[model samples]
Target: MTQPSPNTNQLFKILATGQFGTFLTEDGDNKYVLSMSDGGYEAFTPEELERVCPYTIQIDFMAGGGAHFKVPKDHGLEEGDSVIIGRNFGIVKKLDTRRDNAQTAENLRLIVTQPISTQSPQVVA
Candidate 1:
């Protein structure tokens, strides 16, 4: 069967319940969300070196299946917006919402500013 072509306003669905342990935004700013799963999936963390930089931090991000959506070409999203992905909830911190290459039709870069804490799960309902 053929898959449907993605729409600009469509949700960038992550079918696989995989995990991305540590990932940075297109820029230096980072938005780390707790991994929300049913105890079945693949999780990975980025390898790091011991180095120091101004305003740098060491974060052990427990990111789960992202509540992800693609940024439209017209650019409808912005930084500081709130995102609630299942058991994860945070505000958008950094936005690398740009299309520098023609290879891709849209940009999917997002960085949340708020840190994950012991709080209620955010359901986008």
Candidate 2:
């Protein structure tokens, strides 16, 4: 099946800090896929690796249970890429979908490419 690309500019407020392997984000206009890989961390150069700070983030859902995404440090988020309210609000640039054989259903999750936190807003303006 074909998947619709996520609007990279879409804004989502994080309801919880992704400190553990789990967190939460406000719903969006589209459904996203959860990534199963290390978001290309294994491909980083030594210099890049030295600057890396990896963390796993999984969006919390009412149904419960989801994949964990190991986001590489500085996952390319830049100015206007995110904001800071009580929690961090970020733009989701990538998304994916999952199909389970047992359930015969497809699930969507956002590929969290950056760390979510209560840190100062990364917005440039």
Candidate 3:
């Protein structure tokens, strides 16, 4: 399989609100909730949501056979929106069971890249 572009694997921070209690990872299952400070519940546009965080985006995939997407941690999450990791594979926002069944199915695959040093070790004099 061809490798994904470097930009494709970059991690993007977004803003979103959590509608219900959701987990980040399957193994750890880190529970994250939305901010109640902005009233009981409110609907925000993708751009507005991004302002809340900075990495939020309107994704199109699936979560547990249901449509899914990724937004910033701060973005207001709702029932329709699924909280997923950057590496959660599968149909991001579609009804594909075959793709959904695949474990570790990352929707918004976020990758962190760093520059490598090219300097070589100098001989002791």
Candidate 4:
């Protein structure tokens, strides 16, 4: 699918702070079993990565379930772009069916992307 231009109003951002963590769910399990930790800012692209500040983030999964995840200024991110989080840490496999539209209430639907799935990540050229 064709991606909206960078100037399009469909573009949105997700800002996250604090230590980030991820856990893998066992087959047929709804919860993540494995856990990992990371620091500093991660972006969709190298350009976006450059805009982040390097700092140590404290992530505690045992206390809480969710980790800090963000969608940085992804001007270059397209529908098929592989949004790699922390090197090859994770890759964006596909964007959810939801679209971003700042002008309407329907736009409030949070855009979800499957990055850690088994599918290979796609990056638009």
Candidate 5:
């Protein structure tokens, strides 16, 4: 097995931020959803981190499964905006909703990427 590149790991960062979230949209081609929390990003306990930034993104699979990233409320991101994660880059968009109140029924922003390679998962030891 080989080590995962920093760029390849970037997508995991976005997915790991969710305290709790459900797939707003999922298909054979792609998946889009919001990951946020009133408690905070990755903050398991209330006072775990002094600076908690709850964020969200919309990813596809082009740059490793992400095309557009969307965030409810102005979490310092807007539509048509682009961001850099590690060595990879992605675009951003703002949803006309609040993070706490965001839902599939409401319009959501999403980061689109490309179809992930249909390869078997690899494990490194």
Candidate 6:
């Protein structure tokens, strides 16, 4: 079977404080595959990783249940891409397919690459 390309219609958001890599501003047209995950309201892309910054996931995606905003197989995303949302980063771990009630499905799993939070422990005096 063949795969489709990315569509600009579908979008996701992220939350960030200081600079956090290359992100699309609200004023610009949607052309990214990865962006803020805390209400970014825009698509994102990782063609450039130099545009890094501090960020935090808008939703609890690294937990047991799973994230709220997820891009199914139809999203046209592939592996080798590291997604940076807020201060969290996950790589397109792998592309796998599962059957759902006889329906063939493909899903992308982003493996968190940030390891741990960059924030330092607070020094309470």
How far is each candidate from the true structure, as Cα RMSD in Å?
Answer: 22.0, 21.7, 18.2, 23.8, 21.1, 18.1
Clashes of each: 3, 3, 28, 4, 23, 23
Instruction: Rank the models by TM-score, top first.
Output: 5, 6, 1, 3, 2, 4
What are the TM-scores, per candidate, against the unseen true structure? 0.22, 0.17, 0.20, 0.17, 0.25, 0.22
lDDT scores in order: 0.32, 0.29, 0.34, 0.28, 0.37, 0.38
Which has the greatest TM-score?
Answer: 5
How far in Å is the alpha carbon of 104 misplaced in model 2? 22
Cα lDDT of model 4 overall?
0.28
Question: Residue 63 lDDT in model 5?
Answer: 74
Per-residue lDDT of 1-125 in model 4, one digit per residue for the tens?
A: 53222321112232333333332222232222223244332223212211122221111233233122323333333433333323222223333223232112121122345657888789999
lDDT of 4 at 62: 31
* Pairs in clash, predicted candidate 4: 14-71, 24-33, 80-122, 81-123
Model 3: how far residue 69 lies from native, Å: 3.9
Runs in model 4 deviating more than 4 A are 1-68, 87-90, 94-125
Give the per-residue lDDT of model 6 (tens digit) for 6-87: 3333233323434342343423443454454444443433332223222212223232222323344365556555454454
Writing each residue's lDDT as its tens digit, candidate 1 over 3-94 gives 22222222121224333222122122322222223333222222221111122111112363222233443444455665543444555444
Local accuracy of candidate 5 as per-residue lDDT tens digits, 1-125: 53222221122223334344322322333333223334322312222212222344453233765533334444555556555654555555343422332222234333445678899999999
Worst 10 residues of 5 by lDDT: 4-13
Which is the winner by lDDT between candidate 4 and candidate 6?
A: 6
Residue 45, candidate 4: alpha-carbon lDDT? 24
Looking at model 4, which ten-residue stretch has the lowest summed lDDT? 101-110
Predicted candidate 2, C-alpha RMSD: 21.7
